[model samples]
Target: FQISLPSLKERVQDIPVLAKHFVAVFADKTNKAALEITDDYLAALKQYTWPGNIRELKNIIERSVILEEAGKLTTDTLPFEITHTQETGNLSSFDLALVEKQHIKKVLNYTKGNKTETARLLNIGLTTLYRKLEE
Candidate 1:
């Protein structure tokens, strides 16, 4: 008898449970108890075409847990292919600088105009945040 499990893409409904399980596993292994994940991030994960299947999702969750800070995971923790790719088209020809600027602005807004926290949340340096704001 053989039992077959579906691919990550086919088991999208299971992502949240699987993601939490992976996060807990990685977090305990890494000594980092942070295990927060945003709804948008899970939604993106569900929609993504997982060529690497379960292994891919495991890696993604592990990486996200490893990089997670402030006990929360946002869309920024997602892979570039998942975040930068738009439904309308790819970002190959897109103005990434503008995108960065907009992202900074959004994060800044999210952080309530706190430059230091915004920089931390965006995973950029204080100087870089200042420079981007000036640009």
Candidate 2:
């Protein structure tokens, strides 16, 4: 007998639960303490179409867990493709600079104004981060 499952996008509610489970599993594997996922992170996961289904979600969550530094899974750890595609309809402009500024602010908020960690999470040099802040 065969049983079929729905795509992750079709079951949006499950995204958070699955993400939490994956974070726990990966965190344990990496010998890290329990990690908590932020609501925004979960929202982003749910916003994605999940073309690769559950396996894709699992991979993304594992990647997030491994890359996480603040002991919490925030959208800063998510790939640009994923975070960039989320709810762009609400944006007033598609200009790269505006998007970058907004993204920097979001990461800063996630880091609780910790510029060093924000730069680290954004994968930019501390000097570059300050430069962007000046812009």
The deviation in Å at residue 31 for candidate 1 is 0.7
Clashing pairs in 2: none
User: Which tens-of-lDDT digit does each residue in 93-118 have in candidate 2?
Assistant: 35687679878997897789999999
**Top model number, lDDT:** 2
- Model 1's C-alpha root-mean-square deviation from the true structure amounts to 5.1
lDDT of 1: 0.79
Q: Which ten residues in a row have the lowest lDDT in candidate 1?
A: 84-93
- The CA lDDT of each predicted structure is 0.79, 0.85
The TM-score that candidate 2 achieves is 0.67
In model 1, the clashing pairs are none
- lDDT for each residue of candidate 1 in 1-135, tens digit (9 for 90 to 100): 999887777877888898888888898899986677888888888777777988888998777777667687777677666665565256466676767787897688667799999999988899999999899
